[model samples]
Target: LWRVCFRRKLRPRQVTGDTTYGTVENIVAVEDAGIQAFFPLPDFDRRTPFFGKGTFTYDPGADAYRCPQGQLLPRRKTKYTEEEVLYQADSTTCNTCPVKAECTKSDHGRMVHRSFYADYLDKVQGYHETEAYQKAMRKRKVWVEPLFAEAKEWHGLRRLRLRGLLNANIQGLLIAAGQNLKRLLAAGRRHAPCGSLLALLREPWRLSAVYG
Candidate 1:
């Protein structure tokens, strides 16, 4: 989609999606293309009882995280498999701290993993607090989701019959075309005048003749 947009010289202001499309890679790619990505960040930390990752403040200049208790967690190691750098608090400091119980139960103290693309993720996350983001999300819910729902439920897109990537793309395009044609016909009917309806009913052969 971004390639097509670039080729056509279409400069979109923003892109919107659900959490499924909110990966760090996607956020970075869209933002690097100079478009705002309005999507919810997938926060798995929210399910934890301890202080969530959001509680930590990132200091880009220091390349460290400031904990809720004001302790700086310095970069410990990079987990290349996860594409993140781990920042960890000193275990001795955490063990003696007043907020240890609230922070973590791990013997190794509190740790926060910052994605290599965290800067972009931070920008995208900040967009969640904006009016434009809210408006875009609302529009996506009403304008975009229903088309996907219709395609999956009514257009046999729940599972693809084709075996290859190219075939699947073709099937999806055909389904979308069919969906668009349905909407176009419905719109035409709604806009047709009573006289036109009567004429079509009286001379059904005219419809066949015109279409043919």
Candidate 2:
């Protein structure tokens, strides 16, 4: 979609989606395309009882994370498959620290992960504070989510009746077309303006891809 928009000189200023599309790779790809990524990161530490990942501050000059206890967690290893670098505090230091109980239960030490694309993720995280991000998310909730809900509830989209990618794609396309036609007729009944409706016609693929 970004490429299509770029080629047509209709590049979107921001791309919004739910957390399912918030992987590090996707966030980097969207931002690298020069569009803002308005999505929440999958915060694995959100429910952690101990100090969360956010409690550790990164020091770029030293290439390490400073723990709340003022200990520097130096880079330990890089897991390429996971696309993240591990930083860990010294086990002996952690075991002896006064706040060790609040930090981690690991005998090895407190650990923090820095993604290969941490910079991009960090930038996207900052977008949470922007009004533009809030507006985009609001639009997504209103304009995008209901289409899926309606499909699942009324259009037999709860489960696939067909098998295989080709057949599934065909089924999805048909369902989206039916939904579009229904909306088109409803718009016609209300005598809606043509401008946005025509834009919708031009981007039918978006409906198929999104709902599918």
Candidate 3:
């Protein structure tokens, strides 16, 4: 969506979404295209330390991570995809540490997998900590989430009526049309219901036909 909008020169001020779209790839794509993305970071893995990644600091000069117990986790090797580098602590050193039991359950010691886009992700994490991001999140909650709620709860859009992908897309657009008509009616009731209803019925395609 952002890419299409960008190509059309309809540059948005910012992009916002829930956790599912708040990924490192999406954030980097938006930021690279010169747009600010407002989103919260996903929850950390439960298997990780309760202190989370905050307890593991990255050292760029050494290309290593400093564990909470002060052990260095050096870069071991790259994954098959080459998009991620695995950093591992020495098993001997980790096993001897007094806090070993609390630190890692793996006998090979704790490992941190760093992505090629880790730096971009770190910057986005900083954005997530800001008040502006929180405010945008609130706005998203009000504007975005309610549309789905109304579609599902009132418009019988809880389940897809069609099977194939193209058919499903058609169904989705129909539901969106219904929602737009509902909003138009609600607004029309205030001043010009008869004219608005006639205009809507007469030119429904006017609302959906434009490509750019």
Q: Which candidate wins on lDDT? A: 2
Off by over 4 Å in 1: 6-8, 193-212
The model with the greatest TM-score is 2
Task: Point out the worst 10-residue segment of candidate 2 by lDDT.
Answer: 203-212
Can you write out model 1's per-residue Cα lDDT over 7-104, one digit (the tens) per residue? Answer: 77778999888999887778888888888988898777779899999889999899999999899999999999999999999999999999889889
Ranking by lDDT: 2, 1, 3
User: Where does candidate 3 stray beyond 4 Å?
Assistant: 2-8, 45-51, 163-165, 190-212
Cα lDDT, all candidates = 0.81, 0.84, 0.77
Ranked candidates, highest TM-score first: 2, 1, 3
Which has the better TM-score: candidate 1, or candidate 3?
1
All candidates: TM-score: 0.82, 0.83, 0.80
Candidate 1 clashes between residue pairs 3 or more apart in a chain or in different chains: none
